[model samples]
Target: YQNDIGQREAERGHLARELHDNALHQLLMLKRSVEEPTAALEFPAAYELLVADLRQIISDLRPATLNYGLRPALDGLVDALSGRDENGPAISLDVSGAGESYGPEVDLHAYRIVQQACENALEHAHPRILTIRGRLEPDLIELTVEDDGQGFDVDAQLDLAKLVAHKHFGLAGLYERAAIIGAELQIDSAPGRGTGVRLTWHSRDK
Candidate 1:
């Protein structure tokens, strides 16, 4: 399952790279071309917004940072989001258990799970503070994304997550990803205590 997911991710990354280098560049050039001094009031602005959305989709489809090791990839994730809005949820990244490295598949899935969790926090939770924690233990690797935001009803959301694509939730996808890697997932949230998503897989699972 890990191998299959890895291959799919690789293909998505390749396609993302191509779109970014070819199609996205063309869009940029077109935007520049339409930026005439007397162009319509909304054309340039709308096109510019479209270009930005394309870039974000490319990034989300497959994170380029995962090409590096997991720690740096995690760093890249934080770096990409940290400066996007000065007033947006402040973020911090902490990595512990020095000199321990999981295999590539573990890193890949874990990275993605954390990334999605953060996106959920930012988009749904409306968090004021976001944090990612990575801890590599002798027997297990744990990754956590926690937030300070308006929490939700975990029971209802988890039920809805199980129904994704129809009545689904974003965390539903994360649950499947965790399953593929043999990781146990825990979601803790309430009305005001914020949300925390934790994924832990045994080292032997690698």
Candidate 2:
């Protein structure tokens, strides 16, 4: 399980590098093109547009507030998820906590968990409302992703001979991640109801 988590982390790092080096680099260059066109264009208007584009690009790169604190990081994450194209469901993100730094592994795992949940909602659930919430105390951080969509029968799935015969990896992946951070992953879903997943980690203080 440790090896699997390590491999996934490596893959995520590689993908992040590709996004930063290729996609973000192009966006920055495009932003510069409009802002640095010599005296050929309206300087003020072009500069303003470029500034907005640059802000978005930089936000995509690292998120300004995320570096400063948790609220910003989550704000940036919600913004990114909510900004998905027309196919994406409406999403609401709520965060609460005093400023405190978490281990990099915790932050990364939390971010990836939300990312996966959002993907599942978009590609599978077809939800109308998706809410991502995060709460932190002095000793723990809790994250939850809930969607008002058709849910599944967890028990039935678990009982299925085929599923038991071949290990399903979706929930397993999340379980492994929670273990890495000494956290717990709770999944609640019932047919005809909605689905909600919770990830909670013990704080260093604890």
Candidate 3:
């Protein structure tokens, strides 16, 4: 599943690049065409709007924030994911105790883990607050995504691997992801309380 996810992200990046290049080229051409005062295209404003929307889509598909580093990228992602609901899921992020960089691969996986966790919470939790915290210790790193929302019975959800065998790909995928990185994944939740997703990885992991 990790391989599949990586491949999909590669494909997505490729597609986004192609789309962005073509759209940008066309947008520039249109601007030049309109710049020729003789070319009487009254829809230049519409073209500009379309270009802005297309640029936004491209950014959404392939974020350049990753180039700045993991934590910055995650900060941008949180801003993008948080909704404008006055009373819904006011998201927050915290990063602490940085030692050596975790390397690009670990950062990639870490970002995906947090991204998916926030998405799942937004879709199902209907929460009042969602927080994603990262703690980089001397020998290990831990990520925690917590939400105050409608919680569930963890044991009921597990049912001794039965739930894992079937539906709930979001969570099962998270489990597989943590294992792939030699990380420990934990869930703390109870009905009417809230849910917390935690991923911990020691520096010894490959």
| Candidate number achieving the greatest TM-score relative to the actual structure | 1
* Alpha-carbon lDDT of model 3: 0.72
TM-score to native of every candidate shown: 0.70, 0.66, 0.68
- What lDDT would each prediction earn against the true structure? 0.75, 0.69, 0.72
TM-score for candidate 3, please give it.
0.68
lDDT string for model 1 (1-206, tens) is 44345445655776778777766775765665577655446566657766776776766665666666567778889998898898898899987864244666777788888887998899888888899987867667788899999998888767632445343335666877788788999999999999999988886644
Ordered from best to worst TM-score, the candidate numbers read 1, 3, 2
lDDT of 2 at 45: 58
* lDDT of model 3, residue 139: 66
Please provide, for model 2 over 49-162, each residue's C-alpha lDDT reduced to its tens digit, 9 standing for 90 to 100: 556656765654445665555655776677777776666778888768863658566766666666667766667677888998878776778889899988888776644234
Ranking by lDDT: 1, 3, 2
The C-alpha RMSD in Å for every predicted model, in order, reads 6.5, 6.0, 5.4
In candidate 1 the C-alpha lDDT for residue 80 amounts to 84
